[model samples]
Target chain A: MWLDILDRGYRPGTKLLFALIRLLSGQPLPDAAKVVFYRPDFYGTRAKEFTHEAMRGPSAWSVGDRELMAAYVSQVNECAFCVGAHTATARQACHDASRVAAVLTDLDSAPIEEPLRATLRMLGRLTREGKAGAEDMRQVLAAGASPEQVKDALAVCAAFNVTNRLADAFGFERLTPQGYEAGARHLLKRGYR
Target chain B: MTGGHLPPVANKTEGIVPDEDDKQAAFRALADRVLNGEGQASARQRAGAFRNHGLAPPLAALIGKVADRPAQVTREDLAAARASGCTEDQLFELVICAAVGHSARLYEAGLSALAEATGEGSPGHVA
Candidate 1:
């Protein structure tokens, strides 16, 4: 069931969603074809470039790390779109199957190092509590993650939140569990999420 | 929640008749998602709208809810954004604006995590 989703084709609504993800992630709805379900009206047009970039490239932090961050954060938020998207990417990156499984099944065991852990933890706390402490970012920086890395991680968290909500909110065009895994692989191989 | 709705945000200008079962099933799933996952009023609103209008449920309705937290690290998405040239401040605005601005609960979590992990007295705690 999960793997089958990988082979499914896109439809109009799904395309719109694709566009929305792109637009929200910073891609533009201006891009045509099936990927426009998200709509710039919701995610805005400004995020286009940023979203486009997420599709491929190395990380200011680490592409593998970024994918994992997204996967963890998305799971924290309980977003299927994000979970599927990031999970697919994570698998492809294949940093560590055990670590990946840990993050997927037990978030407490995420494989990344400190500063990032602090950031993700903070993000999770905020999601649970609705307001993080001032020190979370500080701790992240202290751990050697730059202010920039901290903030970008924030973007990953934020984007995933919106993306997850949107995906879950619609609850359609879902990928199968297998496809979810493959999708992450596609992103990782392509270097985007 | 109802299955289908006309979409309070939309007009009757361009759309479909809507599959009742699909919309209903999707809404039920979405409602479950909010209850079991993140608690967002908008999602509830959508669910309510679904019930109100009688739309069909979506496919996301079938899967079990995902756990709400994580404790591992495996990707470098953050580093990539930085490499994309987003400064700390930009990243800050981008994240906060994106998360909170987009979803209240998610926003709260994003901020809280930052504070807890980076806030004072938490050195090496995250590691």
Candidate 2:
């Protein structure tokens, strides 16, 4: 990690909790978890709340769809850790790992529905260029996404945009496939909170 | 007000209905908290990161890179900012601000796009 303090700067209680989590899980807590725990009140608490609602709240988008959006945004931002973490979660949630891989590899030839493909296009533009024009939104709508769906997708985009940046800035370590699977299971069970 | 019509008409009614969606409400609260709430960093520092302006050289550079191209951020960036005397907690808060600020901009753009697509808040659009 770029920041040594963030790597090992937990309070005593948090440290004990981390130890317990590691012992039970058979793997150290991911650096993402560690960064959030480092300062719950400062930004982590609110970030977690927003993420939970965005990922698990009542929305037209499915859990798998949202996870895939996150992974796609991470991919655009070049955050390997989040791409791995959310790609695993997307696979688990959707139960279509190959399709997920296909979508990541090439959105055009990936066989996803037009609506999702269009939404991903918008998200990619927003992530890479930091803005999407009205025409971009119109494309998604033309592809059969509702206005509400656009909002939902934007929420997912916002959350991952924040996470991808932090993950890269902190230099979060990429996990093994097994590690990502385990973490995905945990995330699916517990949600982002 | 005088000259109000001379100014560009504000898209004052633009934006999603915040109270209607629990998720959007929570996101608004989180944005407010991250940019305005109490934290280890000074309010000015947080605001600077949020607006992507008015920062010291090292912090400005770090936040700009983190928000625009995080993949390019290196250990030296953080080290340079640290050398400028920010504690780890403060740096953490600043980074969050930059990230959230950028995300918020994107969110706003998406909302505006949606509004335009739906004619929800466009001036002179008939219901």
| lDDT of candidate 2 over B5-113, digit per residue (tens) | 1111111223444223666666666667766667889888887887688898999999999889899998899999999999888888899888888887788778777
lDDT for each residue of candidate 1 in A52-73, tens digit (9 for 90 to 100): 3432322466766677777786
Model 2: how far is A101 from its true place, Å? 0.8
Give native contacts recovered, as a fraction, per prediction. 0.27, 0.82
| After superposition, candidate 2 runs with Cα above 4 Å error | B1-20, B123-127
Go through the candidates in order and give the clash count of each.
97, 0
DockQ of every candidate: 0.12, 0.67
List lDDT for all candidates, in order: 0.43, 0.83
lDDT of 2 by residue, A59-85 (tens): 888999999999999999989999999
Q: Estimated TM-score per prediction?
A: 0.49, 0.91
